[model samples]
Target: MGEDLTYLSFRVIDKKGRAHILEITLDTNYPKCPPSISADVPHIFNLDWSGNSKLKDAVVQFEHHVDKLQDFWSTLDDIDRSLWVVDPKDPHFAMSYRQINIGNDCYITLSVNASDPRSLPQCRFLGSDANVNLLRRKWKINCKRWVKDRSFSENLTSILDIELPQPPEVRKDDRQTECGVCYAQYLPIDDELGSKSGSATDYTCENNNCSRAFHSVCLRDWLRSITTTRRSFDVLFGNCPYCSNPVAVKIINKK
Candidate 1:
C-alpha cells in the first residue's frame, strides 16, 4: 500500500512574526513508526515518538490527510499576518520601525542585518550627549530581559517606559573642557586683537552623550581620518564616532 511519499520542508512565520524552519519526514515504515517532525523553534512543536499509540494515530492521519497538516501551518501564517503590523509610523511595530524614538530626544536605530528575533538586535543610540549615554546604559542593563521576552514590541515598550537619570547640568565654563575625541582640554585661539576667540573652543559634539568641547583643529583632524573629501570640495560626511549618527564637517578655508 505504501507507494510514494516524500519529506516536506516548510519555512513559516509565527503569530509573533518569528520565522520557524521545519522538516517533516515520513519514515519508510511510516504508519508503524511515527513521522519525524523537526523544527528550528522548539517551542512550537514537540514530538514524543516513544511507542505512543496517539503518535501513530497522528502520523497516520497526517499521511492519510495531508490537508490537516497544511491547515495547521496556514493557521499559524494567518495568525502572524493579523498580529504583526509592519508599519514604520507605529513604534510598536518592531519589524517596520527601524528607528525607535523613546522620548527625551533619545533614539535607538536597529541594524538592518538583525533578522533573528531570538538574538538581541544590534542597535546604536542617538541624541544629545546626555540622553545617548543614558539610553546606552539602560540598554546594557535591560538587554537580557529583552532576550528573555523575545518580543520586540514588548521590548520597545519597556525601554520607553524606563526612567533614566536626569541629564547633567551644562557647564557655563566649557572652554577648557577636555575634547571627547583628542582627550585634551580645549585652548582658545588668539584673535587679531590678541584676545581669546569665543568660537575657538565652541566646537562641541551635538550628541547628548558627548558635550565635550574640542578645538576646531582637533575636530577637523578627527573627522578627516574617518571620511574622504568630496571630489569638488573638501567636505566630510560621516557618523559621530561615539554615536554613529550623521555628521558633516567642512574644511576651513585659510585666508
Candidate 2:
C-alpha cells in the first residue's frame, strides 16, 4: 500500500466554548502548492488569497510546514487553550458543541486553509450542507471579527472571561446528586440511552461510606477492565471506580 499522506490535526476552542478540529494536509506536491486545511462545523473558512496568504505562503514556500504545525500544536497545549469538551480524557478529534446563540447539537465542520502559524486561517463549512450554509451566512454577518482573529489562545481567553470570569453558578440539585464515578450529575435518561436497551439504568456505588453514583454501563465496563480477586466464575468485582472503597452494583429498571 502507498504511504499515508502527511497531515496534522489540531483541537482548537472558540470564544463560545465551541471546539473545532483542524486538519492540515500536505500532498507530495507541497511547497510548489499550498497545503490543504479543514475544520469542524459551522464551517466558515475563507481560504482566498486576501485572508489566508500567510498560510498559503508558509506551506508553499517553506519546507518546514511540518515543524511549524507541531509548534502551533505545542503552543496551544502549553497555554491550556486546546478544546477538551469533545473527549475529556484524551485528545482524539471529535465534534460537539455547547448550547449557544445559534442552537444546540448542530453539527458542522469548517474547511480551512492555514499558510503559516500567525496568519488567519480561511475556512468554509464542509458537512451537513444546509446547516453549514445557514451558519456561514450568520457568521459572515455577525462574527466577522471573530473569524478574522482565529488564534487558539486569543479565542480561549475571550471565552474564559465570558464563561468563568465570575464564579460558576452551582445548582443545588447537582450538588446533592453528583455522580461519583465521573463527578458529574447522573442523567438517568442519558444513561439509559447509552446503555443496552432494557439492561439497566444508572447505578450507585453501594458502599455506605462512598455515596458516589455511576452509570451502570460505566461501572460494568470498569469492572471488566480492572484486575480484582472478587469474582463469581467469570464475573469480576472491584473497588469503586471513583473512591478506593468497596462497592456493589444496584441495577435500576429503565422508566
Candidate 3:
C-alpha cells in the first residue's frame, strides 16, 4: 500500500508463469465502496463488490479472471513465436489483433477472441486481389477443420495450405539494427565527415503493418527524391519505401 493507506498493489503469477501487477485505487470510503481495479490484461474487469467484500476478495476475483484467459494467451504466444508478425511491431499482452506476413507481399490479420480463443477467429487477408481471392477460397475450405487440440501455427499451416514464412535471423555480428534503406547497421564515418551518433538508424515507420527503419540522413534524402513528398519546417512527409504508408522524418540540422 506504499505510505498511502488508500492505494494497494498485489503481484500475481498466472498458471502459465506470466507475472502481473494488480493495482487498486481506493476511495475515501474504501470499505464502504469498491476500489477500482487495474491490470495488464486486454480489457477492464468490473469489481464484484458487496458490503462484506474486502480487499482480499478483489484479488481472488482478478486471479480467476486471468486464469480464464489462459487458453487465449497461450494461442497468442504460439502465434508470436512461430509467425513473422509485422503488425504491432512491439506486442503487448493487451493487444488482441495480429498481422502476420505470409510472403509475396501477402499478409493475414486476425482478431483473437479472449473468451474462446481456440475457436476460429475473425480473419482477413491483405494483398493483391488475386492473392486475396485465392486465400479466401482456401480459408472457406479449411476453416471447418480447425481443432482446439492443434496449436495456432499448426492449424494455420494446414488451413492456409502454404508454409508460413518465418522472420529471418539477422547476422549476429551487426545485430538487427540495420536500416531498411541503406541495409547497414551504421553509416560509414570518415575523419573528414566527422559524423555524429545520428549515423545509427534513428527513424522508423509508424505504419502498424510496416515498421522499416532508416537513418535520418538516408530517409531525408529518399523523401526528397520523391516528386510527391511534402515538407513543413524541418520535417519531411512521404510514403514508406517498402509499404508506401505515410511516414514523416525530422530533418535535424547538424553543425
Instruction: Give stretches of model 2 more than 4 Å off.
Output: 1-66, 75-103, 111-114, 118-133, 147-150, 153-255
Candidate 2 residues 146-206, lDDT tens each? 4334554344334222222221333433332554444555444554444444333255544
- Clash pairs, model 1 backbone: 128-207, 128-208, 128-209, 129-207, 129-208, 129-209, 129-210, 130-208, 130-209
Models 1 onward score TM values of 0.31, 0.25, 0.63
Deviation of model 2 at 239, angstroms: 32
Q: For every candidate structure, what is the RMSD over all alpha carbons to the true structure, in angstroms? A: 20.9, 16.5, 14.6
For model 1, residues 78-190, the per-residue Cα lDDT tens digits are: 22222222223312112312554545666667543212333456787778998788778777877766643334555655654564333244465643376656565644554
Global CA lDDT computed for model 1? 0.47
Among the numbered candidates, top lDDT falls to 3
Better of 2 and 3 by TM-score: 3
**Would you list the rank order by TM-score, best first?**
3, 1, 2
Q: Which sections of candidate 1 miss by over 4 Å?
A: 1-154, 158-176, 186-199, 227-234
Model 3 residue 97 CA deviation (Å) reads 2.0
